[model samples]
Target: MHSRRHPIRNAILVIVGFVALAGEVGAADLVAPSVQKTLEASFSAKGQATLARLAQDKTQGLCTHYATSPIPAKVVTEITAMGFATIKYPADGEYLGDWQRGEQIAQSGLGKQSSDDVEKPAGGNCYACHELTKAEIAHGNLGPSLYHYGKLHGDNDVVKKYTWGKIYNAEAFTACSSMPRFGHKGILTAAQMKDLMSLLFDPRSPVNQ
Candidate 1:
């Protein structure tokens, strides 16, 4: 007769293995082949999600490795540099679209879920992690309140570029940030990004009002 192992025990083994491997490896990489294999074995492909999701990219691998301790300045610099290199500015030099469309994008949380329509454009889902307006009482506190964002930052080329860059690749500013790489990873299109820009920069937007 055989006994099935407990899930927590298996997790602990992975962590222990990670520590041992870290001592041998220069970077404290957590996604060992075994770890990835285990993760892949747990989930079957569903809808838009695939086994490829189990694989970690360089940034993700680095972030996971450094989760237990502070990242060195060298690694931080590398991460930010990689992020900045991935941004692609609009051809027309425009940084904003309609604020009304932006409002809708910010409010929607659809697009990336397993059941979401892949053909449809993804939403910014901004309110999930930020307070964008006083009227909307429901908002998460994970990220900073963005209400009055335009009033506080002021409108200018510098502000506009910074805002666009930040949205495109937040990790360029704050390494290992949980914010989605909306532009860097092509999660949001150029037009969608402009709309989100308007949501933050337009005076008439609820974020400013």
Candidate 2:
């Protein structure tokens, strides 16, 4: 005897198939101009944050495209090169600083918001995405756990330069890293970055312990 097909099951299957197809079709479509217009109308410039934040630079545009689809090798190379080239190394030629100060900078998550005082210095916010010291139990792990970073790697020239560059602009190493461009974007001052570096590399620092 032949089994009879349920009409409700058939209808549900058809609806699911149509939904999947519509999703695929919608994936390639650009964001609606109306949405952009709405954002522009709603968002007001405040303090350090400005309307220019809405505009995507070359790297940002490429990153956005890569999120939706595969980015070409040449584009990735170009983006990385651009990021690397833009790094502004410390003019005084000092790379390390007080680990205590660095720890404070890394732990503090203040500055750059509209509510924050623009005159005050910005924080590194490194602890937000990395595990720096054993003492700090409240740390995120979006990036690798950086505890004992210098102990494991040793304070070699290569390690020092790479650490500096990574903190300066994470995108220089990774095309679409979630880590902020701390130094390049002026999120943290050179002195603040040096302090964070010390926190990472200093043998006396709690991170090394």
Candidate of highest TM-score: 1
Candidate 2 C-alpha lDDT tens digits along 1-209 = 12365644443333334433433223223234454455566679988788777665666655655664566787678778988997887788778999999999998888877788889888888888889998888999998999999899998878888899999998888887788888888899889899998999999999999
- For model 1, how does the per-residue alpha-carbon lDDT over 37-116 read when each residue is reduced to its tens digit? 67677778999888877666777767766766788898899889988887788889999899889888888899888899
Superposed model 2: Cα runs more than 4 Å off: 1-35
In candidate 2, the residue pairs with backbone N, CA or C atoms under 3 Å apart (3 or more residues apart, or in different chains) clash, namely none
TM-score of candidate 1 on Cα atoms, chains taken together? 0.89
TM-score versus the correct structure, for each prediction: 0.89, 0.81
lDDT of 1 at 38: 75
| TM-score, prediction 2 | 0.81
